[model samples]
Target: MRLLEAFRGTAIQLPNRIAMAPMTRGRADDTTGVPHPMTAEYYAQRASAGLIVSEGVWIDQAGKSGPGIPGLVTAQHAEAWRQVTEAVHEKGGRIFAQLWHAGRVAHPGVTGRTPVAPSAVRQAGRIFSAEGWTDTVEPRALGEEEVGEVVRDFAGAARRAVEAGFDGVELHGANGYLIQQFLAGNTNRREDRYGGSVAARLAFPLEVVAAVVEQVGAAKVALRISPGNPENDIVEDDGKEVYSRLLAELRRYELAYLHVIDTPDTEALSYLRPLWPGTLVANLRSEEPTSREEGELLIGSGLADVVAFGRLFIANPDLPTRFALDAPLARADHDVYYGARLDGYTDFPAFDPDPAKFACSARS
Candidate 1:
């Protein structure tokens, strides 16, 4: 196909089309959500991807992550992120901070404050805190004025991302976070302008996108949306109306890409792709181990411009190399996925055979 031909040729050059999906490595310092030196090296090691979407980074303190999840809110966070982005850039990599706000998913114990959402809905799950796992508390419903403040927070974060040297920013409008919670009918039962009809329900998210686009440029902003896979209590009955209209509006902004998680029926991608004007990234696990042929086929057939590989990128530092050579993939360790230490985070070995390389790679 011309896609493969374009990618393989020198004249039709773009870097590698495979992208590293943002995976939260809870290795940031607990008191402050600043990334460490090791974090820079970790991302720099995997600079081969055409793009790297850094893990879900909190836009404001209210949506701050529990324990070790890094944030991009403060000057300190921006400085630390500068180091990370500079390191990746030195390695000839492109990166975008994935702006996140984990509304109902956040706990007061972690934020040291009240959780806010579209409504005072309690997520039916436990969130990992510094003390330990705790049941999610009911979030306070945001007032109208306060909702506008949150949108400003998103714009502020996007500006911070640019200052921190990111090539772009991806709004984490997926995975049942603040925006998704509001978008889904089951979670958001408000009678205000932010809820009710599907169009009204999507107001906040759409506004945030428009704000960020104004702060950054249209080509520098991307949106990630999961239409139907209810991961963190996001339920949408009229998924077609909500997502189809959402995509239609998104086309107006001329976004860099739309990253959509694959659903069981593949309804989201199937319905939205024909209408989307920008690049589309389809994220899903169609098989146990993703083959180069599979990724090639997707891009080759015009299904996606890029395929985001999650766990496989975690275990294999040289994922692009492995894909190019069609090597056996490594399995990621689920045990140490989160924490302040680098044990399972930055310790994953690279393709280098040198003992010192392995030694330097390992962390306690």
Candidate 2:
């Protein structure tokens, strides 16, 4: 299938076109912000993927959203991630650390500080914390000086991710996170240079991306964006202009890839795909997980250079192998999707075909 073919068009060469989309699994130490030992084994199990974008790793303590979310802030956190990188490298797999920051979605109950955003816009949303789910409070509007600090935090985290032995780092500029908070018109209402017009609203995310690219080379940088996604109560009324200008500015840098998260409500994928100059990674959103045929058509049609699978990679660690062998896939348990245990994390075994049973059935 076209999806299983080797990819060489980008700065990063891949063994296949199948990518493991990043998914947040709350399995890290809540206090230390270090990834658990199982985290290493979990990623290594899926080493057959062409590339693995790790679950969101917060850049700073205050950037963390809730318990068990991993961070790359301190030396200890970097060392813990070293094991994960080494394990994947041992199996000849490439992985990228996704840097994340939750702006207004961060609850003081979790980080013990008021959340910060480009403006004081409060979304009617819920945020998880040590005290459990609580109403998201109106965040403190970041001062112009404070904005530079957040940009530096992203740069520092990118440096640490490279030191931790990640193949590269991808800025989590999607799904209504901190960067998206700046991009969305409703979330960003500041009159400063960081927010106002489409150009001003594009300033913060572009600054973060540039800082990360300078910290590491452009060859080691990638970005993810979700346009028209209402996640975390985000509203992008001027999404077309913002995204169009964002992509135009991004083309100035020769980055690794641009990951686009698709929503059924928008034709952003087809609209933006042709605009990107470098390698493009598409996570085509649907009610069900992306199937092999759908992935095949996506790659075959030239809409995306690589196709990323989220839940499919959760259950099928050897997903590419299953696609090649035409074997049955196992279903993942939704209850354990976010937890500290190995029940639904690493316990799901790879596809194992029983030749003996097939032989008996053929004889019968």
* Candidate topping TM-score: 2
lDDT of 1 by residue, 67-93 (tens): 888888899999999999999999998
Task: At residue 245, give the lDDT of candidate 2.
Answer: 88
Clashes of each: 0, 0
Give residue 114's error in model 1 in angstroms: 1.6
Which residue pairs clash in candidate 2?
Answer: none
TM-score of each: 0.91, 0.97
Sequence-dependent TM-score of model 2? 0.97
